[model samples]
Target: MGRLFMLDVPENTSIVDVARHLDDVTVGRIGPYMVIESGDSVSIDRRSTDVRHAVWYSCVAGIEGWRIAQWDKDALRTEPR
Candidate 1:
């Protein structure tokens, strides 16, 4: 499983919204964190979220069972570790 914990904040709202709508992905709350989980991988397109670079780079609060394979101007992709 690939799990990503994103900080719960206005700057990250779009990212959370996108994650909620993805197939095979689950979104839940853990305190102030928005937990995103998937059995295969966790991938989010940067353009889809419309977040600025500062917000995009700092949105993640934590992660589990995965390693970030891609995080750039294009997308944020994770692979099981």
Candidate 2:
């Protein structure tokens, strides 16, 4: 399984939206944190999220059972660990 945890702020809401839009991905919440889960992997495009640079760079609050495949100003891609 792959998972990413993020702070549930206004700027981060789009992250959850992106995760939920992906096939087979689940979106959950732990207090103020948004948890994104997938049986495979999770990849969220920064552009699609429409967040500014600060939010984009700091959106990932935690990662579990996954590795960052790519993270630039363009996108964030993760793979099963």
**lDDT (CA) per prediction:** 0.92, 0.88
The TM-score values for the models, in the order shown, are: 0.95, 0.93
Give the per-residue lDDT of model 1 (tens digit) for 1-81: 778998888999999999899999999988999999999887899999999999999888899999999999899999988
Question: What does candidate 2's lDDT look like per residue over 1-81, in tens digits?
Answer: 877999888889987898799999999988888999998867788888888989889889998999999989988989987
Q: What value does the lDDT take at residue 16 in candidate 2?
A: 88
The lowest-lDDT stretch of 10 consecutive residues in candidate 1 is 1-10
Name every residue pair that clashes in candidate 1: none
lDDT of the structure predicted as candidate 2:
0.88
Q: Cα deviation of 34 in candidate 1 (Å)? A: 0.4
Off by over 4 Å in 1: none
Clashes of each: 0, 0
Where is the poorest 10-residue window by lDDT in model 2? Answer: 39-48
Pick the TM-score winner. Answer: 1
